[model samples]
Target: MTPPDQPPPLEPAELSAYFALIEVSSLLRHTIEQQLREAGDLSYVQFQLLATLGDAADGSRRMTELADGVVYSRSGLTYQVGLLEQAGLVARAPSAEDDRGVTVTVTEAGRDVLARVFPGHIEVLRELFLEPLSGADVRTLDRVLGVVRDHMRAVPPRSARSRRKGAARRRPAVDDA
Candidate 1:
């Protein structure tokens, strides 16, 4: 008999799928990170930040938006943005909509960096991640991943954590027996 507190074990196929997803993600990320570093001297997170801002219609987004879009902690995003600002790759300005808000814009140099690295980035993705799949397989994978992404994103992102009520209080530490 199973204990009530213990959840049912994963089915074999479920376990295999989860492992494959994780391994593929790790492998793809490692290659992409290397390409970003070598081609643009940018870390993956930094590249994500720049790409997100570059895609914006106005080429600017609020700090919180960037944090949410990049799925990064606000503190970490702030530090990366600071580094980019120091490098003259991006600029921060007060948001016109809200006095307390900050807007970050990708500079021409940032755009230039994106342009330089994007070809190699796409190539790495194609060769390592996409090339093995057929057209139908690619479409099915895209659809499945999109649904998973949407399901996961349904939860409020890390950027919203600080704004939640009672989030200011630290949780009591747990004692391990």
Candidate 2:
């Protein structure tokens, strides 16, 4: 019998799968980071922010929404958005729907940066991440990860805590680390 507070250990195969996922993720991100830096002079988080906003139909999202979408801390996202705002890439404005909400919009400059960066981003993904995977493997991986992502998101991690009613518009304390 196990202690009530003690969780079961991962089986060997589970451990292997977890480590492989971590290592592959690290390798892919390293290459993607280099590409984004060189092509758009943007960090991975910045590119994610810009791309997310660029894809938004209204070309804008509330700061809390961006934090959820990118799985980033509110403070970190704020700093990145500040940098983009300073670069004339994105603009922050009062949300029309909620007076207390701040919406972030990708400026034309941000769109231009995404356009410049996307080709190399796709290439890096293809070369370092996707090239070795078969179509069946890709499909299985996508389906599995989608399920995993959904399961994780359902729990409302720290970044997703803004989804709570009164918390939605409240400024989060810095937890960037």
Candidate 3:
């Protein structure tokens, strides 16, 4: 028998998986944040911005692109980038391609910081995240999460008017016959 007014609930296995994901995400972030702060005197967002710029082909990205890549608000990213600029870890300049846009690039100093922080960061990741998973488990997790990410990205958030508008803006144009 079921209660008429109540909505269907997740099965136990589904609930367990959901909660585990949430808990693991929170715990991992906390650990990583502490490690970053202690090792590099860097906040997670600052580290993320530096890392993202470091990985770019030109070691630079447009402010809008960086904002989307880091899941940060444009204004917040501007403030963070300002701090990085002040620290001499990054530089900002008017975009040559778009007069209205700004490009952010990591400095030699930023790379130095990354080099200093990387060893410890890797150790933390290996200890907290990788050690518990077998090779097969790692592979499976990667594949599963990739699918989930693609699905989620394809579907706009509830606040958005439609997936088409949001997803289209995020992805490059493609022609289909």
Better of 2 and 3 by lDDT: 2
Pairs clashing in candidate 1? none
Where is the poorest 10-residue window by lDDT in model 1? 168-177
Q: In angstroms, what RMSD does candidate 2 have relative to the true structure?
A: 4.1
- The C-alpha local distance difference test score for the whole of candidate 2 amounts to 0.88
Q: Residues 1-177, candidate 2: write the lDDT tens digits.
A: 778899988899999999999999999999999999999999999999999999999899999889878877877888999999999999999999999899999999999999999999999989888899999999999999999878756655564455557764443342333
Ranking by TM-score: 1, 2, 3
Task: Estimate every model's Cα lDDT from 0 to 1.
Answer: 0.88, 0.88, 0.84
Model 2 residue 132 lDDT score: 93
Enumerate clash totals for all models, in the order shown. 0, 0, 0
Task: Tally clashes: model 3.
Answer: 0
Clashing pairs in 3: none
TM-score of each: 0.90, 0.88, 0.83
Root-mean-square deviation (CA) per prediction: 4.6, 4.1, 6.6
User: Which stretch of 10 consecutive residues in model 2 shows the poorest summed lDDT?
Assistant: 168-177
Assess the local accuracy of residue 60 in candidate 1 as a C-alpha lDDT between 0 and 100: 98
| Residue-by-residue lDDT tens digits, candidate 1, 28-57 | 999999999999999999999999999999
